[model samples]
Target: MPAGEVRLVFCNAPDRDCAERIARALVEQGLAACANLLPDCLSIYAWQGQVEHAHETPMLIKTTAVRLPEVIGLIQALHPYEVPEIIALPVTEGLPAYLQWVRGQTLPLDKSA
Candidate 1:
C-alpha cells in the first residue's frame, strides 16, 4: 500500500463500554480494519466557552481513506456526545503487509462472496 492510503482515526468515548460498542460496529461494518481501545484517559478541553475534564476511553481505528466518510457517519450516529471527537491521520509509513491487510479488510464486502 502507498502512503496516505491508510488512515488512523482517533476517537474518545465516555467509557470502556461505549468505546467497545463503537469499535465493534466500525469493524463489523467494514468501515474499519481494527479499533484499539486504550486505557482510561484524562481529557481537558474547551467546550461552550468552558474548560472541562473527563476520564475517557481513547480509541485508535485503522481504515482506508475511502472508508473515512462512512466511518465518521457511523460514529456520529452511535456516539452519545452531541459532538464527538473523530480525527483521521494519514499513514505515511508502515509495514507493507500490515497496510495491505488494512486496505483489504476495509473494502466493501462482496455480496456474492
Candidate 2:
C-alpha cells in the first residue's frame, strides 16, 4: 500500500476496436504491462449540458508508478475522445509475484530484471 507501488489506469472507449487499439499500444510501448478490456459497460453521465447514456468498453491498464505519467500522456495523445477518462487508482493489495511481473513488463528492456 505504498503511495505508488502499482496503478490501475481506468479508461473507457466508445467501442471494442478503440479500446483494443489503446490497450495494444500501451502494452507494446511498455507503458502498461497489460490491459483488460471489459465490454458492454453502460455509462450514464452529463456531457456538455445534457444527460447521456452510452455503451462503452472499459480498459484496466496495469502499470507501475514510475510509468504512470508516460502512460497517461500516451493515452491522451491516442484516445479518440476529446476528454478521455484516464483515472489512476493505486493497487492496495495484490499477489507479490503478479505485481513484480507488472513492474518488469512496464520497465524498459535495459532496466528490467
Candidate 3:
C-alpha cells in the first residue's frame, strides 16, 4: 500500500438510474476504472433532524487518489440530493496488478506535457 495513492469513495443514489449514470460518467471520464452497483441496499439515516429510511443503490467506485476529487465533483453536480453522500476512504492494501491496472486505465493517454 502506497501512501496517498489509493481511494475508495462512498456514495449512494436514491434510484438505479442515477447510480448507473454516475457509474458511466466515472468510467468515461477516467475517474474510475470500474463501478460495482449494489442493488437493494437498505439504508437508514437521519436528515433534516428526522429519521429516514429507503432502499438505495450503492456504487462501489474504484479509482486512484489523483482522480478522486474530479470523480466527487462530477457526482455532486449530477446528484439530486441537496447534500449527496460523497466520501473517499484510503485503501491500506490492494492487489499490486489490480491497483496498477486502475492507475494505468485512468492515466492520461498523452504523457508529454
lDDT value, residue 54 of candidate 3: 89
User: If both were scored by TM-score, which would come out higher, candidate 1 or candidate 2?
Assistant: 1
Q: What is residue 76's positional error in candidate 1, in angstroms?
A: 0.3
Residue-wise C-alpha lDDT for candidate 2, range 11-99, written one tens digit per residue: 99989998999999999998899999986689999999999999999999999888888988998888888999999988979999999
Q: Please report, as a residue range, the 10-residue window in candidate 1 with the lowest summed lDDT.
A: 1-10
Top model by lDDT, which number? 1
Where model 2 places Cα greater than 4 Å from the true spot, the runs are 1-4, 109-113
User: How accurate locally is residue 112 in candidate 2, as Cα lDDT from 0 to 100?
Assistant: 54
Q: Tell me the spans in candidate 1 whose CA falls farther than 4 Å from its real position.
A: 1-4, 110-113
Screening candidate 1 with a backbone cut-off below 3 angstroms (N, C-alpha, C), the clashing residue pairs are: none
Candidate 2 minimal-lDDT segment of 10 residues = 104-113
Rank list by lDDT: 1, 2, 3
Which residue pairs in candidate 2 have backbone atoms (N, alpha carbon, C) closer than 3 angstroms, thus clashing? Answer: none
TM-score of each: 0.92, 0.90, 0.89
Off by over 4 Å in 3: 1-4, 108-113
Assess each prediction's global lDDT (C-alpha) against the native: 0.94, 0.88, 0.85
